[model samples]
Target: MHSVVIIGAGGVGSVVAHKCCQLPELFDDIVLASRTESKCKRIAEQLDKPVRTAQVDADSASQLVSLLQREQPELVINAALPYHDLNIMDACLKAGVHYLDTANYEPRETACFEYHWQWDYHQRFVDAGLTALLGSGFDPGATNVFTAYIAKHYFDEIQQLDIIDVNGGNHGYPFATNFNPEINIREVSAKCRHWENGEFVTTPPLSMRAHYTCPEDVGTYPIYRMYHEELESLSKHFPSLQRAQFWMSFSDAYLQHLEVLSNVGMTGIEPIDYQGQSIVPIQFLAQLLPDPAALGPHTQGKTCIGCLVRGVKDGKKRLIHIYNICDHQACFREVQSQAISYATGVPAMIGAKLVLEGQWRQPGVWNVEQHDPDPFMADMNRYGLPWKVTELDPEFQLDTEEHQATNAVH
Candidate 1:
């Protein structure tokens, strides 16, 4: 029987637990831990399988290590905030357990997220004979695998790559983040960076926009290029990628509200003195926003997330699109989460299952792309997230002057 401890009791954490329980043959035991034990218990009640709940501050490495030691699970699935990634990884090492996380580690003081901090721990994890899997969530997780699977089967060498994520879901909130508000605001508000000419080019946040029409009537959305952690690792792992960009759909109303928040300094990450007490504006603002986990019941519509690759195949130019579409209501019915959390959490569970099954269990810190994507891709189909691949005309492209002109008119 394989035992795993899942940290964090948010929407993604809940999804991971529910999916893991669905496969008792693979996961015989699960312990969901969080800062507040009640939150963990709440998630436990939603599960069909019995799950043990524990309390531990993810900010404290010592506390996490203590919990890991007590539980002594084979692996720790970190569905906690990105800020807690490193602490939980450290605990995994101390407790001599494998580690898997959905996102890369970022210092809470900064809005940026990078793989260097966790990648630096590669040798340590290797020396300990433990595998540290990074970016197992949707964008970084399944998207990375999709890129590799396509590259392996469809491309001789992929030169240009674009990852488009569109969430057409509506939760009826004028202003609410699909994930953690602090992380979402910080990421979306950060300066954009894209890889080109073997170097990363910097641009203003959401400065570059394109109109993307998703297949199967998922609806058309305005996608803006932004810096996501996957770009850093994907570029490193796939050297043939000359240009790589990450694009996400955002509503005008959402952007307008974010702009107003930014203008008022409400999105700032730095702490400011308020009534002689220090408080971070974004943190306070997050508290005011609707909880992403609780938005599952109200959210409707779907999300289309995938990679568009232009490369070489058999001495001819080729363009291939691989993607997955997830409906918010369907996910809510199964895991009690919207597509945003469902997209990320499903991949997290798949990655952890692969690790436990020894299909991706290799010692050292590694990104999802570094492994053989075949098994992971197969699991994605067998699991809740089924995908589709379509070969488009070689001339199909995302960013062009035509797209710009169309956006300016609207």
Candidate 2:
């Protein structure tokens, strides 16, 4: 029986545990761990099946290694903070266990997120004969697979790509983040970047915007262009593309709150002296916000995330948009979580299953798209998060005059 240990007991972790437990034939034994044992215990209690729970500091490689050694899990699904990605990877290497994570690593001191730090471990993981799968969450995860699926079946050579993520869900909270507030704020406030003309062009944060109408009545939303970690790997892996960009939908209320927070220095990551102690403003702000896990019951609506690719197929120009729509309420009914966590957690489980099942197992670090998209796409439909693909008009365009004007500057 193969054993798997899941780190982090937050929203995504809870869903990962629930989904893995449902597939006892694959998971065999399930262990859920986090910084707080109580959180893990609470989630385990909600599950119909039993799951072992533990508390370990993900920041400390020694602590994680100790737990992994004791648990003896064949795989470690890291649903923890992005800041602890490398530490958990180190522990996985030491324990000789396969590793999978939902997000790429981001340093705590800086909001910057890139694959360089983790990719540097390619040789080490390969030498250890362990597989490290990165960015198994929704956008980076499913979107990556979506792109690859299109490239394999639809496009002869994908030239332009646009990844659009829209969360039509409403948690009813005035200013709470769907995930970790610190991570959410930092990502949104960072400068936007997009690939163009063989180089990455930077723009002011959320400076570029466009209106997109989602298929299947998911509603239209204003999406702001932003830099996502998957673009780094996708562009590098598939060099045929001329441009790639990521856009996310955000409400005016959320933007207004973020602006106020940024203007007042509440979203700063750097430490500031406060009452004879150093404290990061964003960290403090995170504590004051409602936990993302608690918002599941209140959140309603759906999230649509997909990839829009344009290229040539059989010597003819083609455009395709492939996406998945997840309902927050439906997810809560099954896993007691909202769509944000559901979207991310489902893919994390699928990635780990692929690794353990030997379908995606390889002795090196890899992103989701690096593997065959056939099985993963099949599993997504068999599991939750079913997707659809549609051919777009050849002249379909997402780039607006504003985006063009901004791109012209560089």
Candidate 3:
């Protein structure tokens, strides 16, 4: 039996706790923590079994260290925001606990979504003999695993890659992000970078658009090219990759609202004086938006996320797509969270499971792709996120075009 402390009691955190409880044989003890202890308690109530809840300021490394020392779990599953990733990792290092997170580290001041900040901890983790698994969520998580799995099973060497994410869900809201609004807005508004011909090419955010038709009648939507953290690690690990890009679906109303907010400076990260107190506009705006956790009750639709890889297999050119489809309502019925949280949360549990089982417990900071794909892929099927692979023509391409509307290349 393994004990785990899952920080941040959001939708994803709730999903993780419930899923962990489902398999009591592996995760016998579980603790959920957040800045708001009430939130942790609320998620704990949803689980069928008992789960400990605690309050900790995720922003403070010392507070996390104290919590980790007290709980002394075998692993720390960070369902917290990207901003808290480094702090949690630091706390893990101090407490001699393993670490895993769904997202890469990003400073609160800037939306710099790079892996170097977390990857720099590789040596320290190795020296401490503690494992730190990065990007265990869907895009960076399952998507990274998908790329590696396809490369291992179907390709001799991968050259070109296009990770297409299409979410056909409707929440009946004008402008609400599936995850944290601040992180979502910051990511889309930042400069876009895509790996091409051995180097990253920078372009304006959402400057490149394409039309994608998802398989199995999941519907057709417009996908926008954006910079995702997985591209950084995949390129480094797979040097043969000549071109790699990430694309996500965005809806018209969401884009319109985001543009209006950006035009009015409502999405600004810098704090501005508001009636004698300084407040970050984006953070304040996040308050007015619908909580993503609540969206589960009203959200209904399907999500399709896949990676299309073009490469050489046995000296012959090949193209294949490995993807997973998730239903929002199905997820809500099981975990009381939307598909966005479900898709991300399931992978996190699997990653942590692998770590506890010693399959991926190597002492070092590593991305999901750095581990064996077979175990992770098998668990996806055993758990909820079953995947399918479709062999495409060697000439399949992501045609660039103008598009509008949809969300979740998460």
Candidate 4:
């Protein structure tokens, strides 16, 4: 029987545990761990199936190595902070276990996030005979898979790729993040970029916007183009992509509040002297905001995330939009988490399962799309994240006829 250990007991972590429990045969042994033992214990208490809980600071590789040594899990799912990704990867390498995580790593001191830090470990993991799957969560995870799916089945050569992520969920709060407030705010505050003509063009945060009508009656949302980490990896992996961009929805109210906060320097990541002690403003703001996990009961609406591709199939121009819509209430009913966590957690569980089952096992650092998308796509349908693919007519504004025709020539 293969054992699995999940790090972090936050909203996403809780959903990962719940989803793992639903398939007890796949995950014979499960352990939930984080810096706070009580949080893991609290989540484990809600599960009907027994799961062990542990306390380990993800910031310390030694601590994680010690815990992994004792638990002897075959795989480790890291739902913890992005800053701790390297530490956990190190521990996994030391313990000879496969590693998977939802997001790319960013330095704790900087607001920047990228795949370089983790990708640098490719040779190390390859030599150690361990597989490290990066960005297995929804956007970087499923969105990546969606692109590969289209390229394999529909597109002959993808010319333009756009990843639209719209979270229409409302937590009934004036201004609160759907995930970790610190990470959410930092990501929004950074400079956005998109690849075009083999070069990156930069834009101010939330500067470019487009209106998108989501499928499944999810309604219209204003999505802003941003430089998500997936774009970085996808652009490298999919060379046919001439222009690649990522868009996310944000309410006017949310943007207005963010502007005011930035004006007052509340969004600053640098430390400031407060009461004779150094403290980061963003960290202070996080402490003041409501926890994302607590918003599960109050949040309502759906999240629609997918990939829009303009390419060629069978020597003809083709445009396909593949996406999944997840309801916050449905996720809360099933796992006591909002759709954001559900969307990310479900894929994390699926990726860990893929590793444990030997379906995607290999000794190298990789991304989800690097492996076969067939099993992962099937798992999405069997799990909570059902997807849909639709052929677009010429009227689709996501791409131009010239771009489509160019890929058709490939």
Candidate 5:
């Protein structure tokens, strides 16, 4: 049994803590911390078993270092804002604790989303004999694992990859993000880029579109192509990948609201003087929007996320779709969170457990696909996020003209 420290107290954090409690033998002691101790305390209160709670400013490396030293945890699971990744990583190095996070580090001041920043720590972690796992969340986490599992067992060479993320959940709100509004808006507004022919090709954000009928009664939803951080790692790890892209579904109402917000500068991350105080427009907007955690009671529907791969196997062209469908109501009933948080948080717990149990420990910064996917996949089944794979003989392809027409201005 190993002690673990979890940072952040959002919907995802809550799920991670509950899932960790499920495996009491593996996680002997658990400490949950965030800047707001009350938030952490609230989550801890809901757990069936006892979990220690503390307040630590994740932005301050020294504070985190002190917490880590006091707790002496075997591993630290970071579920905080993406901006605090480096600070937490630095603190981990100081405390000599293994680190894992669900998302890549993205600075608050920049809209750029890439892995170069965190990947730079490879040498430091390797030299320190510490492990740092990046992108353990659903898409980057589960999607990466799915690709690796396919490459290992089924494919000779993966040539093309498309990751589709469809969240069909409804929170009964006209316009509200499922996660942090600031991060969500920034990611959607940024230009889309994908790897092709050994380099990244860029396009307008929400430019390329396609329609997909999600399996398991998910119905048809229009998905728009967007550049995601996972594409960077997958292309590097899977050298045979000639082209890779990421797509997500957005409703017409949501897009219209986003366009209006963009026009009015409400989505702007830049600081503005409002009533004698400087405030980031996006951050202020986030304050007004319903918190993702609070949406649990009202959120209903399902989420379908998966990887569609086309490659060569046994000298023959092949295609496969490996995906998972999660119910929002089911997740709420279990952890007081929607499926989005449950999906992301469950993998995070499993990833950290794998490390603490010594099943996935390694001395270097790594992505989910860098390790064996079998164990992680098995854990997912035991946990909440079970997955399924279906072979596609004809391959999942969208008509170019139809796809373009969908995205065309009405």
Candidate 6:
């Protein structure tokens, strides 16, 4: 039996608590904590088993260390914002606890997403005999595992990688983000970058677009190339790759709204004087947006996320697509949350479970793909997010005319 502390009582945090409680034997004691104690208590009320609830600002390492000292949990699952990742990791080290999170750290002042900050702590975690798993969420989490699984089973050498994320779900709101509005907007509005021959090529945000026809008739949508943190780790971990990129589907309405917001300076992260009080425009806008947790009941449709890999196997070039399709209503029925939160939260629980089971526990800061993907892939099928792997024709190509034209070889 293991005791665990879960921070951030938001949508993903709530699902993590519920999933952890499902296996009482493994997680005997669970404590859900966040800045808003009431949110934690509310989520606790819905669980089949009672979990301890507390309030602590995750930004304060001392407060977290004190809480961990009192609770003495073996692991801390951080479902909080990306900005608080370092503080929570520091607290875990001080409290002598293993750490896991669904996202990498991003400083509050910048929208840049990279794993260098967390990766720098590899020696610290190793010296302390503690484990810190970063990017345990869907794209960075499951998708990373999917790539590793494919490489282990199907590829002799991976030559190209494309991670496509599509959320066909609708929340019935004209303008609302599925997760934290601030994070979502920042990620979408940032400059685009993709790994190329021994370097990264930078482009304007949403400048490179490709039409992706999802399997199972999930609808064809325009996927815009963007720089995601996983691309950095994946390229470094798997050096065979000559090119790598990440793409996400976006609706016209959403893009239009984002453009208007950007034009009006509503999405700016820099603080400006407002009535003698310095305020970040994006933070203020986040306050006015609908809470993502409250959108579950009103959300419908599905999300398809996967990795498409082109590699060589047995001296023959091959392509494989491995993905999972999640329904919002089905997830809500099980966890009272949409598939977005469910997809991320389920993996968070699985990562913690692996650490507790000693399967993935090791003394170092690591990404999900750094471990064996077989166990994680098996758990995904056993859990809610069932995935499928399909081999594509060798002649199949993902590059669109626009993509080819924009990225023309000189």
> Per-residue lDDT for 83-182 in model 6, tens only?
9999999998888999999989999988877899999999999999999999888978999999999999999999899999999999989899999999
Worst 10 residues of 4 by lDDT: 401-410
Cα lDDT for residue 131, candidate 4: 88
Question: Would you estimate the TM-scores of all the predictions?
Answer: 0.97, 0.97, 0.98, 0.96, 0.97, 0.97
Model 4 stretches with alpha carbons more than 4 Å out: 398-410
Candidate 1, position 199, lDDT: 89
Q: In candidate 6, which residue ranges exceed 4 Å CA deviation?
A: 399-410
Report, for every candidate in turn, its global Cα lDDT versus the true structure.
Answer: 0.91, 0.91, 0.92, 0.89, 0.90, 0.92
The residue-by-residue lDDT of candidate 3 on 1-410, one tens digit each, is 99999998888898999899999999999999999999988888788999999999998988999999999999999999999999899999999999999999999887788999999999999999999999999988999999999999998999998998888999998889999888988888887899998899987778789889999999989899989999999999999999999999998787888888887888888899989999999999999999998999999999999999999988999999899999999999999999999999999999999999999999999999999999999999999999999998887677787444222211
Model 2 lDDT tens row, 291-348:
9999989998999999999999989999999999999999999999999999999999
Model 1 CA lDDT for position 234 = 87
Clashes by residue pair, model 1: none
Candidate 5 residue 312 C-alpha distance from true site, Å? 0.4
Q: What is the C-alpha RMSD of each candidate to the true structure, in Å?
A: 2.8, 2.6, 2.3, 5.2, 2.3, 2.9
What digit string (tens of lDDT, one per residue) describes model 1 on residues 1-410?
Answer: 79999999988999999999999888999999999999999999989999999999999989999999999999999999999988998899899999999998989987779999998999999999999999999998999999999999998899989999999999999999999998888888888899998989987778888899999999999888889988999899899999999999999889888877887888888899999999998899999999999999999999999999999998999999999999999999988889999899989999999999899999999999999999999999998999999999999777532222111100
Q: How far in Å is the alpha carbon of 271 misplaced in model 1?
A: 0.8
Candidate 5 local lDDT, 1-410, one digit each (tens): 88999999998899999999999998889999999999999998899889999999988888999999999998999999999999999999989999999988888887877889899999999999999999998988999999999989889989999999999988899999888888888888887888999999987788788888999889899898888999999999999999999999999898888888787888887789989999998898899999998999999899999999999988999998999999999999999999989999999998998898787899999999999999999998889888998998645586332232222111
Cα lDDT for residue 136, candidate 6: 89
Model 4 C-alpha lDDT per residue in residues 18-136, reported as the tens digit of each score: 99999998898999999999999999998869999999999887899999999999899999999999999999999988999999999988878999989899999999999898999
Worst lDDT 10-window in candidate 6: 401-410
